[model samples]
Target chain A: MKSTQRNMRRDILDGLHVGIPIAMAYFAVAFSLGIIAAKAGLTAPMGFVSSFFTRASAGEYGTYTLIAAHAAYAELVVMCLVINLRYMLMSAALSQKIAPGTSRWHRLLMAVCITDEVFGVSYAHPGYTPPAYTYSAALISSLFWALGCALGIVAGNILPQQMVTALSMALYGMFLGIIIPPARKDRNVLYALAASFVLSGLCAAAPVVSGLSSGTRIVVLTVLISAVAAWLKPVNTEADGEA
Target chain B: MEKHSVIIYILIAILTTNLIRVVPMALIKGPIRNRFVRSFLYYVPYVTLAVMTFPDMILVTPTPLPGVLAFAAGIIAAWLRLGLFAVAAICCAIVYLLSMLFAG
Candidate 1:
């Protein structure tokens, strides 16, 4: 029993060591997200609750857009699901990393905080990951994420209009940061990204498709573009770490 | 948005996102074997984020010029593989600078 306690404590400390950097990064990004939430008319408390529970930038961004549009609840559901579908893949990958016969509750708890950065660090662990490690990492990062968001909203309310306008682009910058690295490595990703940009631009301008709500357009385009890319350039799961 | 509606939306966001994360980790034990499904999932983030970034990014700013220029700067910064915070900071700085230039 003493050894088990020692091991768990070590895991928790290790988690914190890795988690601090992730926590800092999340605070910066979540700050931008909070600013966007403020633009969408969300109160600081609202931003805090949203980030605390969701912990997903892209998903929350879509949700804010839907909220601003006064979109239907069904639209919100589908948009959240679609924007966050990548988490499903990440979670599946993580499921295999947990030792067999680990408690189901631990798996659920770990899953609750599996953002991209957290998953990256957790999956890099040498052997089967201890639940305590992930729990500690998640706890530190999630608190920062929520706090940064609430503080961002408060700051947004005080900052000048021009500054807020500038900050609004931060989310897009982060999105570019995400997609561009992969595009730089893979030709297929670059092509898919370029195609998405062109098609999305066209859809916004075209007569009928332009009429679709922004949330609906994003969902439709994501499915359509990704499906075609998959059909045309099916990834070799054995070779590709991304899958 | 009303206070109640915002609360409901936040709940929906939480539930839907957690469902995607928890269900697979809790239930699925094996790697998905289907090649097409794997490929599709692999491409989803790039496509979805790319779609979201363009057009909307340009439209979000007060004027088109600063938005366009800042976007180009952002793409360059990101293409160089700057950290997300750095890229975002660069974009925000560029927008602020250019907007001031245009305003003056």
Candidate 2:
């Protein structure tokens, strides 16, 4: 029993050590998200609540966008589901790494914490990952994310208009940061990005399609572009070691 | 949006995202074998984020010139593999300085 407790403590500490950098990165990104939320007229408390519960930047950004657009509730639901679908893949991958016969409750608890970075760290762990490790990492990261978002809304309210206008660019900058690095390495990603940009622009301008709500338009484009790219490129799971 | 509506939207986001994470981890222990499904999931993030960023990026700023300049700056900074915070800060600074330069 003593050894088991000691092992759990060490795993938690190790998780914390990995989680701090991820937490710091999340805070910075979540700060920008908060500013966007403020621009959409969300209170700081609203931003805090959203970030605390949602804990995904792209998903939260979609929520703020739909709110700003006054999109229908159904549209918001579909957009959130589409934007966050990647997590399903990540969770599946992580599930495979968890040792067989681990408690179902533990699997469910770990699932709640499975962000991209959290999954990356957990998946990289040798052999089966301990639930305590994921729990500690999730705790630290989620707190910082929520705090940064609330503080960002506070700053947005206090800052000058010019500054807020500038800060609005941060979300796009972060999005670029996400897609650009992968584009640099992969030709297929670059082509897909270019196609997505042009298609998005056209969709926004095209007479009938342009009439669709922004949330619906994004979901449609995401499904269309991803499906075509998948059919054309068909990533080799064996080569990529994704499975 | 109303306060109640905002809460509803946030709840929707929370539920959808958590469900996506939880349902798979709890229920699916085996790797998905379908090649097309795996490939589609791999490309989803890039496509979704790219579609969201463009056009919207240009429209976010007070003026088109500042937005265009900041977009270029962001692309370059990110291409150089700067961290997400750094890229965002650089874009914001560019927009701020340009807005001041063009202000009456």
Candidate 3:
């Protein structure tokens, strides 16, 4: 019991090390989402609630776009579903990192915490996060995300409109920060990204394909465009990542 | 109209959101052996993010110059490894400054 307690403590510290920067970055982005939501007729409290389940900036913003159009709930549901579908793929890739004996309950818990940032940080961790530590990571990250949205909504509401409009760019900037790290270190990543542009652009222009909601198109095109990098499996030589 | 409907609506709203966000993550375990599916899952994020950001990088202003300059600003900020917050702040500041200089 004492050993397990020590293990938990160690995991907690390790989780803190990983979670803070990612969560802080996430908070900055989510704050802008809240501000935008406030501008879009959502209250600060509603922004907080909408953000909890959305767990992603692009999809949440996209859904807000639909909501502005006064699109139906079905559209909202599909918008969120299609945009967030990548989480399923993310979760599957993650299952490799988790040990096989991990229980259904544990899988469910980890699944709930499967935000892009969480997956990104977790995947790149130096070692396997003990199942013991996963909960703390989830709790800490979720709290930061939810708190950030709350801050954005409240801040967006109180702050002048000009400032809120300015902060909206922060989300795209966050994406640049994410992509550049891998892109700089690996030419292969750059190629994959460049291909994403061509494929997504083509997918956008084709008349038959272009009519679909942006969410569905994202899932279809990204899956197609990213096939090269993923097939080559850049990080696969490390056996530990697979098992 | 019923008074309790608002409470019901909120519950429904929260429940609906949770269902889309959380339910499948609980149920979907799979064989998932096909190389295409496996690889597709892995790179979905990179491509998805790229597609999302492409427009911003491509078309920032009515005239291409301001937009092109903002594009350069973001590329430089990102290449410098300034992290997420700094990249965002620098890009926003540069855009606002440029807008003031040119658009005004």
Candidate 4:
């Protein structure tokens, strides 16, 4: 078991090497989130807690601004629900990685750590995820994410307002980083991104569909894009380490 | 009616979101065999990020010209595989300079 522990640590380190870039990519958006929190009159810690729990920048920023605007509780409830609803797909995809035969206690812990980052990496590698490696990677990535937000919040609090405003592109740049590397290697991925963009834009531009709630629009777009991509290119991802 | 009660409501809302995200996977633990489903699952993050980034693009001016320019600059910087900090710095510099030129 001692040797097994060493092997697990090594696996985590391997994951860390890959995950560091993911966290660095996340910093720009996470920092932007801090700026949003400040504008919303939320304390820095309040902003940090959003990342700590959800690790989702868009939803966290939406919640912060909605609260700031004194938006309706019912609307905020729906926005939160719809924005995060994609995680359901992420978690479902990650289910293939964990030990299917395990007990509820194990599933409970894995569920807590299943962010988009973890889910993306875990799904890309199908098969038996050594519990130790998967959990440790999640713990480490979550820390990097949470710590980045905490630092960004503190920075946003003290920075000059103009200086903060200049950072609007940082989040886009970060997302670009998260996506471009993968898309560069695969035309299918590129097509999915392009299709999703045009489709979503059309949805927004259309008069009738434009009346739908923003959250509903987003969910619809996600489902549409995923469905099309799945139909275009099928992948059998039942086994572990297939990618 | 109190402020504390409002905070509690927010927390519960957030918790509900987390639960909705986590519960289905806990129960659904079979091999995903649909070829199309697997292919799309693999590509979803790219689409998701692209979708999320569209509305969030920051604009420093009424005209989208400068923001568009900055967006192009960021993509170029990222394509060159610049570090995250460098990509951000370049985008902001372009935006700051453009804002000065246009507004001044």
* TM-score for each model: 0.75, 0.73, 0.77, 0.79
Candidates by lDDT, descending order: 1, 2, 4, 3
Q: Name the regions of candidate 3 deviating beyond 4 angstroms.
A: A1-7, A39-41, A66-70, A131-141, A151-162, A184-186, A201-212, A228-243, B1-36, B57-80
List, residue by residue over A149-216, the lDDT tens digit for candidate 3.
77886765576443444455565676677776778877777888788777766766778987876678
Q: What's the DockQ of model 3?
A: 0.40
Which residues of candidate 1, in runs, are more than 4 Å off? A1-46, A57-107, A114-141, A239-243, B1-9
Model 4: residues >4 Å from true position, as ranges?
A: A22-28, A39-41, A71-73, A99-106, A121-158, A208-214, A236-243, B1-6, B58-62, B73-97, B100-104
Model 1 residue A22 lDDT score: 61
lDDT of 1 at A233: 97
User: Per DockQ, what order, best first?
Assistant: 1, 2, 4, 3
Clash count for each candidate, listed in order shown: 0, 0, 0, 6
Clashing pairs in 3: none
lDDT of each: 0.80, 0.80, 0.64, 0.66
Superior by lDDT: candidate 2 or candidate 3: 2
Give the TM-score of chain B in candidate 4: 0.72
Per-residue lDDT of model 1, residues B14-89, tens digit only: 9999999999886786555677877777677677777778888888788788888878888899899876667778
Instruction: Estimate the TM-score for candidate 3.
Output: 0.77
lDDT for A192 in candidate 1 is 97
Candidate that would win on lDDT: 1
**Backbone collision tally, model 3:** 0
Please, what are the lDDT tens digits per residue for candidate 4 over residues B1-104? Answer: 42433364358556867786679776786767666666666666667767765544533435677667766777677677775556766766777677666666
Query: Which candidate number maximizes TM-score?
Result: 4
Q: Is candidate 2 or candidate 4 better by TM-score?
A: 4
